[model samples]
Target chain A: EHPLWEQIGRSFVHHYYQQFDLDRNQLGTLYSDTSCLTWEGQPFQGKAAIMEKIASLPFQKIQHSITAEDHQPAPDTCVLSMVVGQLKVDDDPVMGFHQLFLLKNDNDKWICTNDMFRLALHNFC
Target chain B: EHPLWEQIGRSFVHHYYQQFDLDRNQLGTLYSDTSCLTWEGQPFQGKAAIMEKIASLPFQKIQHSITAEDHQPAPDTCVLSMVVGQLKVDDDPVMGFHQLFLLKNDNDKWICTNDMFRLALHNFC
Candidate 1:
């Protein structure tokens, strides 16, 4: 991780979780107008669609345990992170997730442009 | 995965492994002129840069065991696949990798635009 980007990455993720934990309704503010999200197998673009996807998630309580995080600087900053955590709506097994985020830093704030999340396991075995 | 996309996805992965196994140099043909590749935490763009990055990998033999694949249809088709497998140069442990591929279908062929890869494990334990 770049020295400057490490700070930005840590702060960006911290701020994201804070806002998300408080109210997912405000999640739209973290993304640009043209941002996109790929959750599970579905893809949604723009704020309205992205918001709808998050709001419809079956899990009401989500806890993310970040295992590894890496940052790359380019046309846009990309952070690849791995999380093995638990999510509960009623009752669910602990699941693992691998996420990739593409963010743009504008006016000292980072805005996500592309987000991808999928199961961490390659096989049940 | 969509029915059509499933076939495309399987064939794509198959062809990729075939070419990659034959010669890493041939991997460039699978991407467009303006494609981008994010290997581990490093980002490389364009054919020259992407090729350079692949050709320089420490591994002499790489095998990707795709665990799950999901496809989304849009302006450009995006396939999110999780792979956990091995990489070896002379003698190396079987390292697991998670990869995401952003593909565009043009002229009845799929071309990768953005490829991201990261470690699958969040914690070593």
Candidate 2:
């Protein structure tokens, strides 16, 4: 295990959410052409498709408040992170959510390879 | 993308939860010496340590009901799966949780290389 895996993972997650809350348009820079994302059961592949899906989200304003997070180093040297948090969208009440991200190093820069998000509500499905 | 990744991912997840709910003792066989798990923010490496943690859970009776699941084949050919669901413990009310797994093929058999789990309760932490 790399001694810096935890630190790198934590910092990457912080940067990700910060960018997401501030301006989702900048989120695309954190992904690459080979990236994939599953948002609320919908799947999108590649940078363009993923960015399109993100930009099309129905919510106008969103803020993520992380309650807990876990990180691990995969055998392939990628960082696997799971984040448990609450989010406020527009004027709606706060809702809980779970998100997972697999980040890999590409030319000395960390980029997300896979991402999955789901709302943590009993009746949401 | 592998044509059978989704099917394989779904089957693997079904088998995993089935064994977990029916008899966690059998769960050890699904992991390998290099497998890693993070349960409720605690990290455990290798199969023996992971199994020890799983067997030490305080709950006597537990059941999981999955509401949604997402799967994607990573660039390294590993299957990344994220599950959102509810669980019942003893006489406690159903509580939402999120679990993630990365399954890799080894010697013609799929084994869980990484696992992360967390409860989705507000005010619990």
Strongest candidate by lDDT? 2
* The best candidate in terms of DockQ: 2
Worst 10 residues of 2 chain A by lDDT: A116-125
Give the Cα error of residue A101 in candidate 2, in Å.
0.3
Which ten residues in a row are the worst by lDDT in model 1 chain A? A80-89
Q: State the local distance difference test value for candidate 2.
A: 0.86
Off by over 4 Å in 1: A76-91, A106-108, A121-125, B1-16, B25-62, B65-96, B101-115, B122-125
Lowest summed lDDT across 10 adjacent residues in model 2 chain B is found at: B116-125
The sequence of per-residue lDDT tens digits that candidate 2 reaches over residues A1-125 is 54587888889889988888899988988899889899988889999999999888899899998899899888678989999888989999888878899989998999999999887765322
* Candidate 1, B56-86: lDDT as tens digits: 8776776555555554432324543333443
How does model 2 do on interface RMSD, in angstroms? 3.9
DockQ of 1: 0.19
Task: Write the residue-wise lDDT of candidate 1 on A22-94 in tens digits.
Answer: 6777888887767768787577879899998888876666655555555544332443232233232335565
